[model samples]
Target: MSQATETLVFIPEDISSARSGAFRADWQMRSLAGETMGTHWSAKFSSPEQLDLQAIELSITQNLDTVISQMSPWETDSDLRRYQKAASGSWCAFRPEAFHVLERALSIAQETDGAYDPTFATAVDLLGFGPSPHSGYSYASPEVQQAFAQAGYQKAALSAETNSLFQPGNLRVDLCSIAKGFAVDLVCQRLRELGLENYLFEIGGEAKGLGCKPDGLPWLYEIEPPPNAKASLSKAQVALCGLAVATSGNYLRYEQRHGQTVAHIVSPRCQDGDDKLLSVSIFHDSCMEADAYATALFLLGAEAGLAFADKRNLAALFQTADDLLLSGRARKLLG
Candidate 1:
């Protein structure tokens, strides 16, 4: 796998603490890592004593399983799958977790003018990047068009009072864009419940951090260069403190279909031409939101994506073929 060149490292204060043995004597740094959502996840925290590492790892895995059960497009028995097969115009209630994710998705779709739609499952599957009944279909085929026509995030009516969702027609929902980040956020919460105030949690490259190291310094992450780029390239690092970051890029995930290479990300607007934008990274208070926005910004390409980010005052970094651009908000925050 191509690695993100930027690695998180302990700051000078942390090095000093390690040398003095002031923090290590009183606190133990424990770590757990495992697989989730077709990728790996990890958690690192400082605690005064040894923890039930086995139980904590199991809980983290179970949490990821719960998310997959609710959102995986590959699973036929998933709640989303059942909803997709349900009769049109029928109401399907969601579990609390699924409900919350869908609610946020719909809101983001509206906010981005459908830039980050959960209803792009058809296009995604058609591209052979997702599982489905729609795979192997050409992008311009009637079936793909019909599926796109039938799906729209706006059409799905939500009722918070009843915790029920009503599909206007044959809309199929896929939560791939934001589900992993939500899982990361959930793990962070679990860590807090274990009385861990200083920790970092990551799932599928989307990460969030809280508090600080025992030495009172923040966790740092080096944003990597685009995939396939020479690793000798350097990028900036950001300190994580009650913040989450997510990156979306086609360089990492794409497949050749019909003699043409198509990326995994599908734009609801129209076919993207000569996709020049390489990658996008977003920072936000919520990992889920960061994930969703990263995808949206990537779909919008460089110019429009930068404009949108600036308009929303979002902290976003867009990497193009030749250079890296930071939104005004990102510069203000990271500069």
Candidate 2:
């Protein structure tokens, strides 16, 4: 059997090497993990002398539930689903949290010329990649075509002052590309409010870190190499310090449609599966930005994607069918 790629793996560090001065003498390395958004999440941090694991876990779960309630398209009562069901040409009162995500998603979509779009909800459902999977969905069907037609970021307008959103068409927004990363950042924020630093936060494959270990060493992460025949997850690791990382890969999350295999990622330009690149990883100060850009660059393919990252001096790594490429800044970070 071909092993599935690990995608992202935590690299354990020797506690002795971490800086100790910032923490108490009794400080200990601790790890916490849970499942959320249909995937697992984890956190590692150096704790001071006293910490309440139970309270922290409860807070984490509550925050993640709030995130899902606001943005998950899978939930019928979610704010996103409510917006999708809203009548066209009507402005709906939007939750500030959901609007924030949409605003950032729209910004990235515009920057990438619609490569990373939040308006793929219908396409996602038709492709059997959404909460409810269906067989026999076709890209050529009128329903699917209509879904494509509703997919322009320009069609959605946000009012920051009123916290309202206008859907100009039958547009339905999906935040799968960026919500998890935003959730990770929120969890990190929660930790900060509790007076904790030196933590690594990850949900699904999106991750962010702040401060350093007790010994003051940055968290390390292993980005699986280009998938192989066996599809094992083994590769060189990178160190991340006060940064965030997110990756998009076509090896997994695929479905069979019309007797052909297709990736789950939907491109706004093609309104179909994007298959040009094998994988792309993005590093940024904000996990949300990294998550959205990773999907965007993957859809842009190797040449244009690399150029995009290079022009912005973004830290990114791209893996193609035949070669591995890194943005100049990413190369330096990896080096």
Summing lDDT over every window of 10 consecutive residues in candidate 1, give the lowest-scoring window.
9-18
lDDT of 1 by residue, 7-40 (tens): 3222222233322322443576789988877888
Report the C-alpha displacement of residue 97, candidate 1, in angstroms.
1.1
Candidate 2 accuracy as TM-score: 0.87
Clashing residue pairs found in predicted model 1: none
Clashes of 2: 5
Q: Give the TM-score of candidate 1.
A: 0.87
For model 2, what is the C-alpha lDDT against the true structure? 0.76
- Report lDDT (Cα) of residue 259, candidate 1: 59
